[model samples]
Target: MSFFIRGRRRDVKEKKGKKRGLKNKQVLPVKKSKFDSGLDEEITSDEEEEYLKGKVNDIAEKEAEDVETAQEKKVRLAREYIQELRKERENEDDEELDDKAVAARLQEEVLESAGKLRRLVAETFLEPVSEDFIVLKSKHQKLPITCLTVTNDGKFIFSGSKDCSIVKYSIEGKRLGHIPGGRKGTENLHTGHTSHIYSLAVSSDGRFLASGDKGGIIHIWDGETLKHLKKFKSHRDAVSALAFRHSSHTLYSASYDRMVMVWDLDTMAFVEHLGGHQDAITGIDSLARESCITSGGRDQSVIVYVIAEDKQLRFVSPHESVDGVKLVDERTFVTFGQEGSLGIWTTLKKRPHHMIKRAHGCQAENGLPNWICSATTLVNTDLVASGSMDGHVRLWKITVDRGHRKLEPLFSIPIPGVVNALAFTSNGSHLIIGIGQEHKLGRWFKDKKAKNSIVVVSMKKNV
Candidate 1:
């Protein structure tokens, strides 16, 4: 198969301010007389070369236009299909012959149709050409927010940042002012990475606030007074994930050292290290009686662990290998980073019932960077979102299984930036996405054209 044909991909930027079909209109062909015998070989040769280039450019331009039109048509078709699906379930009964069979069949059908759209779109835009931001009620905080911890009541927010400080705010991102653990010395506030906070969590009662730092320390603070309650020197490695098990007075922290250690939140005492994974534990979440968690690294496998009766944690009955996993509910999860793959795994009864892989908006195969980060759930905790290294952020409608660890993606669309962190607003309407290179936050909504649409639709609406 060693054919000797040379190929190079060149990115063509759309000429700004040019209307559609303008390039084609400008490619008036050279007259036959121009290449006639009256002209010498050297005469007007440069002019002829320029004309030839213009002709080639014209052809390329038309081809690109056709590709763009086809892509738009594909997206329109997908929207129509989703609307039809919504309508199909409008009058349908849940107790037909087989609800499981019906859902599986419908999911398969949707996935097959989505797969057919892989050849439809051209992923050539660096920033989304159709990018738009629909503003929501954003809370402007005095201190830059490094990590967010939302209270169970959903009213109070606690933020930790590089200012070597922690502060409380409302849902709208307002500062509640210095608590006891507030950046004490005004002179030392900007001087140290002492508060180079990475993660934040709040107790269910909103009484306790906890923040973790790159210094390998986890600070437990009084939620109301903002005083340093207790600090745990838990791990030698950086504390990546930390959470409070509210119901049982337990605290959990995951580290780059590849272990999830359980602690007694009431006593602030170390409990046990849940250690079977071979890589860094990325995220941890707790469900009733069972704790769900994700551990992955360069090895590229995500394992879910649940605490056993003896207070030791073990992999859930079925060991599932996912590129990345984020649990939004006891039964639902989201997975990305593989197989034209945006997957939602539904594991209700100990098996993946519905698995949907949507290949609709992935980057082009030609020359685009195809790296996609892990999907994070925002907007009511049901919306799964992801951003590719190619600079497009995408959203997915997802459902997961609590028992079997299945994930299914119902719908998907693109966003902006390489999404490093995904966090939701107090209400599910807006999401704050951390961009990797930009280091700034961008907001994303469910709609494709959200600026004009959100303004018109949400002018009076609050969320």
Candidate 2:
């Protein structure tokens, strides 16, 4: 179906602003009396031609100027980016040690410093937009959304529900599909979980998807295909949380049985069980280093376990029930609890460096502080996000410079129901939240109007 049409190029310059009139070249009417007297009217043809030529010249000049300006802007941006990189490299070199005693120490320190600079630059490039955060999209899952996780590339969001199914959604909030749940029946019919799916995790490499259910079962799926790969029994009780070690196949699972178990993903084998929490382990997260952290429910404790040493360290209790735990950095982490307590702890210390007994204001009808059920940290930034049963999602910034750390309030947004899960997109552009009614005893109807839904929040550009 190839076809070619001969066309002439048209360089048309549209007029902008006020229209100019060629007053001198106005079309004159010749009088009949003058024609009868054999008189001829003088014409300004030369002037008219000169005026038209000048107009074209002006338009051409303006277009050329615009093109040059755009080129200059591009070059300026390129130069600034190059300069930033050079500055980072120079800073890396400026920290060189004078001592030749430890060559290994020098090389390691240099690489660490350079890596830090690179991360800082990368974060700066994706700084949240300055505009007001918006509700970009909302998805009704028709079941209580218990957990949600955004993929590493920010293309998809996987949500687990009380119905025991894992539904996948695109970034635009379109339902793509769902993974088949539950055990294979003898009838060869596909079914989902028989219990609530409470925890969801995606590997850092974006290759694997894992979900934990109320029956203490963990299901593994191919991240790209969303196909069920394997299912295994992990704990005696329900699995409360799951986290994958960054850049590794190792996975850490926290269960209501008060056990933290590490799994070898490649072989689907249990590596070891970490026992420290006296009650249910409600929240868990892995650090960039070879370690993981967990928070207990009824026992109200936060435990840090070092994988290399195969031991626990720095056990502390900050509240009655630490419901949410998030790793802010390799050394620092944050925890929130049922009493609305928010605490910042460092691996170097046994006690929390900063604490807020009641971080959120809303209280239940019984005067109990709203429990914070979930938390997540913005990568490469000091910001932490927490969602509570008070129907509010709050953001906080932590400062840890020179041991004088403080938790500063940034902002809070109200949700229609309890926020069960919270995660930031890999690029920090959107916040994916699982929101629904907080199931309560003898309060079945309160959740009737609370449609199970997933909310995607756009962040303030400058945030």
lDDT of 1 by residue, 1-463 (tens): 2333222111122333253446454566766665576454564778999978998999999997777776788888767765565555644565453445555656755553332111111121122222234322222222223345566666665555444455565545455755323343432343323645666777777777777766667777777877667777768876766777644567778777877778776787788877766776555655344565564544455555657653432323222334445655554555554343555544433333445443334455553334444456642244555654444555554432443323333433344334344554434434444333322122221222221100001101212
- Write the residue-wise lDDT of candidate 2 on 421-445 in tens digits: 8898867778888877754111232
Q: What TM-scores do the predictions have? A: 0.51, 0.69
Candidate 1 displacement at residue 65 in angstroms: 81
Clashing pairs in 2: 128-461, 128-462, 129-460, 129-461, 129-462, 130-461, 130-462
Off by over 4 Å in 1: 1-146, 160-167, 178-195, 246-248, 308-324, 337-341, 346-374, 378-382, 387-393, 399-418, 425-463
RMSD in angstroms, all models? 30.9, 24.1
Q: After superposition, how far is residue 244 of candidate 2 from its true place, in Å?
A: 0.4
Off by over 4 Å in 2: 1-140, 180-192, 439-449
